[model samples]
Target chain A: MLAEGRIWKFGDDIDTDLIIPARFLNVSEASALARNCFADLRPDFAASVRSGDILVAGNNFGCGSSREHAPLAIKAAGIAVIIARSFARIFYRNAFNIGLPLIESAEASEGLAEGEKSRVDLSAGTILRISDGARFTAKPVPDFMAGIIRAGGLVPYTIERIKAGS
Target chain B: MPMTITEKILAAHSEKEVLSPGDLVQVKVDMALANDITAPIAIKVFGEIGRESVFHRDKVALVADHFVPNKDIASAEQVRIARDFARRHKITHYYEGGDVGIEHVLLPEKGLVLPGQVVIGADSHTCTYGGLGAFSTGVGSTDLGVIMATGEIWLKAPPTIRVNYEGRLNPFVGGKDLILHLIGMIGVEGALYSALEFGGAVIEAMPMYQRLTMANMAIEAGGKNGIVEPDEITKAFVKERGPEAEAGAVYYRSDPDAVYERVITVNVSDFGPQVAFPHSPANIRDISESGTVLLDQVFIGSCTNGSLEDLRDAASVLKGHRAARDIRLIVIPGSPRIYMEAIREGIIETFMEAGAVIGPPCCGPCLGGHMGILASGERALATTNRNFIGRMGHPESEVYLGNPFVAAASAVLGRIGAPGEL
Candidate 1:
């Protein structure tokens, strides 16, 4: 449950259209969306992003569209987790439903800078700045949501639940 | 303890004795829907889950309005996937080809959504059903995929925000203006995770179509859903829509002592048609204050304002005058049904004679998919929801959101003027 990665920082209201424009919504494949992640606002994002990278952003990340392409693209692009000051309600649920972890930490969102190395301890809900060693606590994922993430998304979670029988 | 309308509906659907704000509950879904843009992903996830079949065949609906005619190869592939899934699963309400329409508009029109239903769709404007007193909300494709497999969803009940509307609206000012004014008062994320319950004399007296339009924009203010308690008007409409609608209807009203997170009152008597300028739906201004802003295109369509009444209102403004020289006027009916009705009412002919280009019933330009994308630096006025940057076309292009009256008058004037100005 611990993730160590370099940070990719963004500002407020990073909308889904910017993450994956409706123009690219033709295919449902995560990789297709990953290729165009941040295509509008940050064209170089797809080419430069490496696996296990972490995304940090200010408030209202993933606003606008109800499309899950934003989080799917980010996860497929190999971003380990997203840390934001706040997130749009639908996006937050989508991220978890798809097994993409997100942490809400105003302190971490303000403390972390672009391309900085960071270690996120999901179990402890704490993030450590690699360079400065400053640590900030993130809100813990709700117990049920954590269960869904553990099962690797809602689909798998639902499958497990169905197999268990009420 | 008194419960809000949302809480009451959620509790009923979950079969729980009661529910309060922030309580986590698993609720049985009455209806689940997705469009071409979202259905592909949900279908993929549904397959990955390895479920034998959908939880309930009749409770699911899929539509292909977003890219109905297939804007491109990718969109065509997506539509094909959705079509294949629908046919393979034997979904009851699969809509495509001549029958296709925007899911939100089409669902209520066909009487699929009813009062007290806990409906969910993979589109933000699913809140439009709340106008019918249903507890409908938008979710993601992943959530929809799960809903397809198991007709249940986990939701944290949201606190209610009551919006009280009073006074009369000026001519040409309607639901679009009222919603714009509310979004202006509260920023885009003002009602985050909150249910917006619209009430008071004005909304009660408003027509059903206008109520749908008003509820459609609830997401613009980041509300989880928007609802109006069912009354005689709603009951009459439901009864006429037929026995299926009335049989499914289960109306619930908020208790008098129900607690609300916030209460905002809007006085509409003195208001004019308000416009949401470029980049955000919350950046609103009265039409009179935003004078002489020339337009490259004027679009009237989308689930937001493409109903028959919306077309009639626009036709009323464009009856004699033609669109300004060099300006393009694009009109799209919300559905094939609405298209036929508009034609029967002579609304389409008025639009054509007035120099407007009539497109088929599909959602394209509203999301910058196709049909009328803006060029760089171009300015277009539209009756659709969401005036976000690049919403209609090029990022540099701008979209001004207004009601049908403002959109039609602006088309005739080739500027951002009001119907009164014409």
Candidate 2:
């Protein structure tokens, strides 16, 4: 099924320190993490977030460090998808491994205003911006990756496969 | 088709022993690591993975850094969990702050890292070991957790990019300067998922410590690992490290006619000190471009640049002069070994005499958890990697990245100055 959410804008190179600082790593409880997501970058990020919001960012989003806390913290904080111009290699895998859907669109970041509604068709590989009627093509998540995400993260997905004796 | 160093190594390490770009290779990992910040989660995931024994008990390293001395009660508990896991697993190398400094520095000092090894750690700066010619990369806790269980990871053998550096470096221009210069040339996305190889006369001339500085920051350019083929310098470093380390001293070279996705040639003599401004490591500026940073604080530490050589360089700038009255200068040695060496060489005393507060060899303040963090709206220059906004303490504080000389010089001037200016 296609998923959609309102857009939250962030600039390029939004690092792990901003997404989920090291100070918070000690607490692995996802709910507590949900409160401090983007504590450094945008102080109000936690309170401002909706249950199914999408983030559109500039190039090199999720750069700096391999802290999975960044993605987990975001996913726990109610972010459904993140559409960036590009993604850091390790962060990309971390997000997908944990079932936090991320899309990369060439112009999803450009012409994007905060709070603008975004309609994403995961299968079609298109992100439709409702306000400006802008349609941007996204780098399609591969079928294998899609299956993993649908299974809700690698751990549970792995468990399901093992349970099915596959 | 010619093979790049990264491709060649992955090919040698893979099960099929023949790899192309994007092939998921599940090879036996030489080592797996995680520090204080990452270990707690890694332990949790390791438990959840339902594997009591790791693939290789002797292939794991756990270090307690990032918030040593237990910044808070919670941080102490993370260190506790890490210690318990290390003991229970009978890890090959388990280090806590007493003798351990940063994981990057401590691993090499303890002779745990070797050349040509493929090392993965939960911490991103795990790339620091690339200086040893190892294909070291960073992964998330879940990935590390899986490795902790199965001792293998699925990875695409990346393409290689060789940097043939030529010419002699200017005395003032150190390895940190060279890496910064490369990042400035390549920008952030230049080497995504690629192995970076260092070759040429310049690399051959570089000391092990200096070469480590260059390889450690390959991540800044988005590369998987920045590696230098082990040579005489590498041989000496490993030889002194003992026999166990000798096993890991392998080097990979591209086939003479090997084709590369990208080849960046750098003339070492042409570069100078580089500073990353604003919020990005890739937002680098040459020291020759702008001479001053109006900095109020100067931090000198991180696994990447916090070392004996790094502190020695900072001491050179702070030898006779005291830090400026308005500026706060803090120096953190990378490891306990480096810390002891600096103390013995009087480098630590020189920093103290010059008004630089010497902190224990840990990742403090560099990550801005504790130590010399910045206040809101204040500007500081640091010798560590990454200056993303709010990385060091106050969210409103500004961070500028440069070599140790620039940081020391900034401490003396109460503002950043080009090399030797202080």
Candidate 3:
């Protein structure tokens, strides 16, 4: 349950429309969405993003439009984790429902620098900066929700439940 | 525990005796909705779940809005997918063409949603049904897919934040200005994960359409839903179109001693029309301070302010005048029903006579989906909710959020002006 990655920092209120614009909504495939992640705000994001990179953003991340494409694109683009000061409620649930782990830590999102390597311990709900060895605590995901994430999102979780019942 | 209105409704839907904030409960959904933008993906997920059929076909609604008239081939294919799924599933409320409009407005207008029911939609403005006393919230496409299969979904009982707006309303200011000012008073995330309970004498006397306008943008301030207590007005409004809703209405109000996470109050008698500037709905100022902001386009429609009353108000302002020579004014009715009513009442004729373009009943430019996408450096004053950057068009374009009166006046003056200026 540990995720390690280089940080990609963003500012406050980075809305879902910016993460994946509505124009690309026609294509629902995860790869197509990943190809255009952050196409507007950062044109080079989809190209330059490396696997296992983390997104660190200021408050109210994923604020506008309830498009789950935003989180789907991030996870599809190989972002290992998202650490934001706070998130819009719908985005928070959608991210978790899709198995993209997110952490909320005001101190970490504010202090983290772009390109800094960080380690996120999902079980412990702690984030550690690799360079300076700085530590920040994130709110722990509820046990039931943690189980859902461990099962690789709600779909797989439901599939397992249905299979068990049968 | 003393329960707020939202808790009571959720408890009823979940068949629980009592509920509290942070409690997770699976509630039976009375209605589920999706638009062209989200329905395609939801249908995909529904197929992926390997379900033979939906749980309840009549309870699910699919509306082709967002990119109506099919802006491009991709968008056309998206709507075609939703249409095919709805046809295959025989969903009772499949809507397209003239029947299609913003789902939030059309649901209530068609009586598909009722008070005391639990509703969920794929679009954020699903909270608009709270105006009629339903406990509704938005979810993602996957959640909609799950609801289609299971007929229920788990939700957290949100804490209530009481926002009491007292005092008389100003002459020209209406629900749009009130909501804009409130969002400005409280930052974008002020009510994160909380239900906003709107009350006071002003809300009590406000028309149901105005209440819908106010509750529609509750999500703009990060509220799970915004609701008003069901009263005689609500009963009457629902009774006219939906006798079942009126007969089955569960009238629940907050206990006087109910606990609230926070309570914010504002007196609107002295408040004038307010506008949210470019980039954010929270960046607001009074119309008087707008300082001659020029406009390239003026739009009056959306789930927020596209009702018959909104059209009437705009027509009243533009009765004897024409839009500015360089300005393009567009007026879209909320639904085909509203469109027909406006035509009968001559509201549409008035707008067209004033040189305004009348479009179909669709959410054209609101989400920057199509119809009126702004060009670079262009500015638009619209009555729709959300002024987020690139919301109406290009990232460089600016959108100012205001009411129909301000939109009409600005159209006439070619600036971000108010009704008083007219």
Best by DockQ: 1
TM-score per candidate, chains pooled: 0.98, 0.95, 0.98
Tens-digit lDDT track for model 2 on B1-422? 66766666666666765567777777667889998887888888878767668778788888888788788888898899989888887886888858678888888877787877788999887878888777788988888887887767768778778888888787578778888888888887788888778888888888888788888888888888888877788889999998877776776666788776778889877767778887777788877676556778889888878878888888887888898898888888988788888989999899899788888878888778888778899988888888877888788888888888888877888876875665
| lDDT tens readout by residue for model 1, B1-422 | 79999999999988688899999999999999999989988998888878889888899999999976887888888888988888888999999989998788888889999999999999988999888888999999989988998899999999999999999888888888998999999988888889999999999988888888888988888889999999988998799789988998999999999999999999998678999998888899988788679899999999999888999999999999899996899999988999999999889999999998999898858998888999999999999888776788787899999999999999999999988877
Backbone clashes in model 1, listed as residue pairs: none
lDDT minimum window of 10 residues, candidate 2 chain B: B9-18
RMSD of model 2 against the true structure: 2.2
Q: Kindly provide the TM-score obtained by chain B of candidate 2 when compared with the true chain B.
A: 0.96
Choose 1 or 2, whichever is better by TM-score.
1
Residue pairs in collision within model 3: none
RMSD, candidate 3, Å: 1.3
Give the lDDT of residue A109 in candidate 3.
86
lDDT, candidate 1, equals 0.90
DockQ of each model against the real complex?
0.75, 0.63, 0.68
lDDT, residue A88, candidate 3: 95
Docking class of 1: medium
lDDT of 3 by residue, B1-422 (tens): 79999999999888688999989988899999999888887887778778899989999999998888888888889899999999999999999997787798898988888788889999999999889988989999888888887788889999999989899888789888888999999989988899988888899998999889988989999999989888988888888876666676677888888889999998998678999998898999999888989899999999999998999988999998999998999999999989999999988888998898888889988888877889999999999988877788788899999999999999999999888887
Error of 1 at B374 (Å): 1.0
TM-score of chain A of 2: 0.91
